[model samples]
Target: MAGWMNLVNEWLVPALVLSSLAAHLVVVVLAAVRRREASGWPRAILWLANQAADLAATQTLGNLFLGSTSREKHLVAFWVSFLLIHMGRPDNISAYSMEDSVLSARSVIEAIFQIAGAIYVLIKHIIIGGGGGGDGRTFVLASITMFLVGIVKYAERIGALWLGDLGSIQSSGKKLKRASLSVGHLEISDDEQALQAAHRLLHITKGAFADYSSDEVEHKSSHANDEQARLAAARRLLHIARGTFADGNDNGSRWSWSQGWEQLFRLVEMELSLMYDVLYTKAAVIHTWHGYCIRFASLHFTAIAFWLFSLSSKDGYRWSDVYITYLLLIVTFLLEVRWLLSALASTWTYAFLINTNSGLRHAALCSGRWRRLRRFVMSLDLCRLALVRDPSSYRMWSGKIGQYNLLSECTHDMTSFYRTLAQRFGSEDSWKEYKYCYSGVLHISSPVRNILFNNIWDKLKLAYKPEEMRAMAAMPVPHDNDARRRNKLDKALRFAPELQDYILTYHLATDIFLQCSGQKGAACAFVKTIEVLSNYMLFLSVVRPYMLPGLKIHSLYTATRDALHDIW
Candidate 1:
């Protein structure tokens, strides 16, 4: 019976623990690479991570409490270290779904149960004699240190889920707003009262429970240091209609450069970034000095435990058990170092880089590989979108930006035929890499964004209150010589008042100009680019109406959508 029990302990228990840890490590790698895409793979990986962590925890406790093998103390230390490193998951993602965030209370309860189990294992095995002989002193010390760190790490995740709930965010917004910052006046036509009302919204929306100091971003928002800020600014401009291509509100939109749409966009993006950090990153808990102090204490404790284990005798322990203990020690240190690097790469660190003394900032930016590191920190995009070139182009923006006819549907079949033909003839490398689209969205280069924004701004100037127009005229256009020309937006903008007219005309024009002429046309790629953008911009209008107060709602999205079947 004693020999049989040792066989089970060495083989079955070890297998269970190794399987759990191996599954967790694989899931961690997949989640890091694919979390951004809205796909089934990410969901599957998150599920595996959660399940593996639980399995590992249960196995660790089992080995600690019931083991009689001579290698018991070493296995206990190894399992505890496994739990700690597993707890230190990637910061950018916590829960896989909104429902997961809502279940945060349950998560906390489960964490409490796990903690209790771990404590029970410790008292029964180390303090008593369940671990069976040998100096268990050093093993208990190390297990305690890892348990504390793991507990705190798990607690942070549950707390982040609670914070991440959109309902909680909305509730906080309602309580906040002790004082509203003055948004400057928008002097526009009385015909465009919607535009005027939109301007009345305050930039910094504070939650009543805790004050969010959004004004801290004032200087940061002023500069276009990252792509998000630039995109947000483009959305703030009021020259486009919300839906459809028809002009409605752009005539009266006017705000000064310093305090107008630009500043508002900057503030909006920053607040969202803050909320994302609270939900996904360690900003809410670990960025604090207290968090850092505890982190270092845990590290010191782990190091001390390592030293103690080295000094202690290991006469009866199996060689494999000795190797496992050292493996856990080395892996724990590696994880801690990795966590340190992740914390340093955060946006919180970027703020310090920007404001610190000139020499440090310069060194960070101009030094060898440090510049690449700084760029990585600065360009962290929370929301990334890519255009699926083929499927993405299939839809129209509010049924206005492009038109669909029975004939045009056939044209798409032709497009498909050509694409297939091209694929067959193309090199294997090119075919393999090509998507119906590429790895990106409607927005292109900076120059394109500038032209798109300025074109709408200029058109809206026609309706601005006379005084507002005069003020804008006095200030310099944010872009340079070529952008000032109206021709810059000619191709990009659908100048037609009726979105139907624009789409139908473009379809008819392209078919007649390209297919009739027996060619894809000199401007085929350009035309396709404009068409894709029009559809995407229209989609953005309906789904994210609040983001684009200027042109987000110009077209009658439902109305146009309703008419689509009839047109087809």
Candidate 2:
């Protein structure tokens, strides 16, 4: 019976912990994979797998000291290192959503509990069987070093959690003060063509939005180019329509983009990078000087401690424990390597290398080759088929942009799905299968944004009021508001000098355009495209108010939402 119990302690328990540890290590590798251009389901599966492995490893470590008499000192030290390694999550991913940051308090509490558990396990091991695998003093000191490293890494995550919240950004006294200083000024960048253009336009629109002399804003821009101005204004409207309110503050909001919408594909490329930063990367601090410091410290400490453990004698320990320790050491260093590679592969790294004369930039020497490499590394096909989705998929993750459908908006929400309407309402005699569903792909070389931006810019130029033009321009302006009528109320509202009215009015006009055009020619298809995109923008404004520039739309959106809900 004593022999049997020893066998259980020597093999069974270690095997369980090994399984958990192996699962955790595999997740650390698998999580490195990015399927941004791939379908959404694969990413979701990978994320779930990583989370499960994390929980399992934590539980198994706790079980190490639970009522059992198998107190191995080396096992305790390995446990400390595992805890630290897990805390150093993939560089690209922090909280999966804004809500994750909100609930991060729970994670903080759990970390505290785990820390306490580690303390208990260490104490219990000392009382039971003594030092891990070497001289008592040496093992204790080694364990302490790894523990401190883990604690520091864990603390960084807690800080990230506290700061990553949308509410937190608004609440941070430090960040808010910095943001307040820039509200009235344009954030210019010569490196980012669209952002530079937007900066100039922001100067003019900032005045229209609030209190500023348009003359002073224009005077400051006497040296700026007009092409940047046009492209910026167009891209800004697109960002507004898409629910990406990139800037915020006391003075006003500014939108920035690296590529102009005129080239089209470049905007798509840059959009992918920006979305990744906001959604996954810790854009808040990971690229900062302090971020680099913490990463270097964590890496060096982990590698050093792992080397010490690798060199220590392993005689007195069970064979299973010895094997597991070797495995842990190998995994720790491998993860560090993977982490470094991920940091290099980030968009922030690319920007940093471009802006500086860092000797590390030889990898990206040729611009054309660099772009091709970027597309291959950065793009992923995010396909969540609208026609074949379950309700659960919608609840799993909330994107920066909510889903939209023009046909559904014509009716009540949740009462029906849009594809059903397309099928049921169609003229069956014309063709057999008429199916329309919207599944967005993130990495297509589509020029749809460029088309939309130019069209909107032209409309704004045509609709500019006399005083508005005189106020915004450095010289006399052209008068071009003589276009034919299309419901004066809608026309006036659509072309109103205010940006908000443009968002609302265009939504209404598209519906009217669709009703009048009928579903036939090339004209109909073009009108239909405008209608869907335009109405979707309005739907986004209503459903996702936070993503819009700070504005008052409760009553208007409520009425629109109520009407849509009824039809839905």
Candidate 3:
């Protein structure tokens, strides 16, 4: 046993130390070669220095174990090796040129302790004379110091891991909160407003659907049967109109704000899922990179463990050496576990991307189905309108002519005012003046008109005053001497309220649909339709005197004067 121990101590330990040094040198050389094309030379110098230190340490360890008469040489080599280890430490190495005072202080303290320990080991080695002659107490103290250093290094690694986890959790929570707020604030109320908006939306939707449907039908008809294409087109339009009306219901209605929020949240979630899928794909790539790092680290750790084991086993392994081997094994185990987790994460991320892509495709299909249904409803409505001979035949048609007459008178008054203004002013200047006048009249009269005739009566309740705020309101509103002509206008401006409302609703609905179709030409057509409708209403008003009852010419004249004044 003593002979075997002597052979291990004198030969095996020194050989193993040399092998470890050679391996380290090879690694440093490879690192240098790989980084040769790097922008800077400092990294290459550092790696070269590390390799030199490793070689020195290997030589010193081998010579010390072999009882070489070169204490100064061993000490110098040991110091160099220690310095290299300290430099490799994450906290000890700074990316910038500026030294970190706290890290420097810690390093100095560590170096002091290491130097003291090295001195004690040297003294014990000198007394041993090639035999393990140190007192157990000295060995224990040395082991304790080494253990403490390992603990510090491990604690630092753990802290970094915890901090990363905390940051990820915080970021995830903030994203969720933002998504929640976006959904919470997207509610709409006021049925009248909703109905008006819906009508407008419907008009736009119908117009867009019609144009697209016509084109699609023409294309289909040219290739196939025209009758079938026409039928399909009609069905598509009707479906679109119905869907638009259904979708336009305000949140306050049966659909509710909660439902809208739920839908929007679902959309956001779906979008997030897609984003996550992309991130997952990226993470997979990152994981692959990390895997390579893990494999490299594992190889180094394995080499270190084997080398340490070889030395300790040869030199009559002490408790300290055994503990270090265990620690190295622990490090290797951790690296293996981390590598496994990274690989799993990469696999999971790839699966997630695939699933998300499928889900997105499904969502697109659902959207297309919904749009098709909406188009079908619109086509049905259009067909019904086409079949009707008189506007009065429709359910929304009002037989009363008083409203029409009233509107007609109002139109005529506006035209006459425009004509007079144009004659008095140059055509170019008059046109500008007319636009401003119309814009102002529309802006002011819109609220009043909406309140008096539409469902905005409740909103105007606070605006009503006992002649106190009336002055203020009156100040904002332009006055006209034609107020006395109200009786004459009431009789002249008669029209069917239901019919007018229906026409306006249809027009608005068509416009809304057109906007949704994402067609620029359809949008232009909708705008043109609105302008034409406004002009037609004005023309009808101009001819009010020849139309129905309840429209007073005098009252309409007063309203026109006020409208023009408000416009200006």
The local distance difference test score of each candidate is 0.47, 0.47, 0.33
Model 1 ranges with Cα > 4 A deviation? 1-36, 39-51, 58-74, 130-134, 170-274, 341-346, 349-526, 534-568
The alpha-carbon deviation from the true structure for residue 360 of candidate 3, after best TM-score superposition, in angstroms, is 23
Residue-level lDDT tens digits of model 1 in 459-534:
4444443454344345564222112322223323443335443444454455556556666424455555444455
Model 3, span 1-568: residue lDDT tens: 9999976755544344344444343443333222112112444455554455335443544444445443222222222222223222222121111112113456556545544444444443532322343443333333333333333333332332222222232333333322221111222243222222332222222222122321121211112122222233233332332222232333222222223322322222222222222211122222333433544454454445345433432234344434534543444344344434333333232333323446743653445642354334435445445855422122221211111122323335545666667667757334433343232223223333333323222222222222422243234322221121222222233324343344434533554455576652343544544444443343233322222223334454456446645554
Q: Please list the residue runs of candidate 3 whose C-alpha ends up more than 4 Å from where it truly belongs after superposition.
A: 1-285, 289-318, 346-348, 351-568
List all candidate RMSDs to the true structure: 12.8, 11.9, 31.8
**C-alpha lDDT (0 to 100) for residue 49 of candidate 1:** 69
Better of 2 and 3 by lDDT: 2
Ranking by TM-score: 2, 1, 3
All candidates: TM-score: 0.55, 0.56, 0.19
lDDT of 2 by residue, 178-227 (tens): 22324334333322543332332332233211222222212122111222
lDDT of 3 at 228: 29
